[model samples]
Target: MFLPEAWGRGYATEACTAVLDWFAGALPGEPVVLYTQSANTSSMRLSAKLGFTELERFEAWGAEQWFGVWSPLTLSG
Candidate 1:
């Protein structure tokens, strides 16, 4: 996660892309997942760019709202 003050500088997107590359190269075919709160539209968009699909919303930690599951194809180079 990143501080809200750091939004729009492409840090999350860039880091996610890099991490995706490393993970795919290191563990080829392994599954990956990312979950973020519902209010985090930025993160939701980031996940979409990285090919993450919203799997389900559940109340696990806080006030009931989360996104989950990212496809392995998201790690494509």
Candidate 2:
């Protein structure tokens, strides 16, 4: 979902949350992983908002990459 015009409108966050929620339900006890460039602040913020915790950081493709994980238990409490 790449929409420059839709940036900062909360659309990405909302859509991602809905998708993650549905996926959690469809596959209980499974974890979801996301990788994004560390320089992308918006993505980092969204990942945190979606209950993703940083698993590691590494240099990749000539840039820093952030690896995160999310799980139903972590999000639900």
Candidate 3:
């Protein structure tokens, strides 16, 4: 997560990319899942950029939630 003051600076994207790369190297065939509020557009964009595909959307905690999954195989094409 990034501070509101740090929004739009690409920090989230960079950090997430690094983490995902590490996960892919460490867990070849395993998948990674991410959950975020539907309203958080930045997170949605980041997930898409990192190759996450939406698995489901449901209401929880009074707000819509997004569930996505990513795998190294998917990224490798």
The best candidate by lDDT is 2
On residues 1-77, what C-alpha lDDT tens digit does candidate 1 reach at each position?
Answer: 77888878888788887887788778877878776787777877787787877788888677556666655565444
Cα lDDT of model 3 by residue, 27-59, tens digit: 888999999999999889999988999999999
lDDT per residue as tens, model 2, 1-77: 66798778988898999999899899998999999999999999999889999999999999999999999987764
TM-score of 3: 0.85
**What TM-score goes with each of the models?**
0.72, 0.88, 0.85
Indicate the residue-level lDDT of 75 in model 1.
40
Give all candidates' CA lDDT scores: 0.75, 0.92, 0.91
Q: Which ranges in model 1 have alpha carbons more than 4 Å from their true place?
A: 1-7, 74-77
Q: Residue 15 in model 1: shift from native, Å?
A: 1.4
Over 4 Å off in model 3, which ranges?
A: 1-7
Whole-model lDDT, model 3: 0.91
Best-to-worst TM-score order: 2, 3, 1
lDDT of 2: 0.92
Error of 3 at 18 (Å): 0.9
Candidate 1 has a TM-score of 0.72
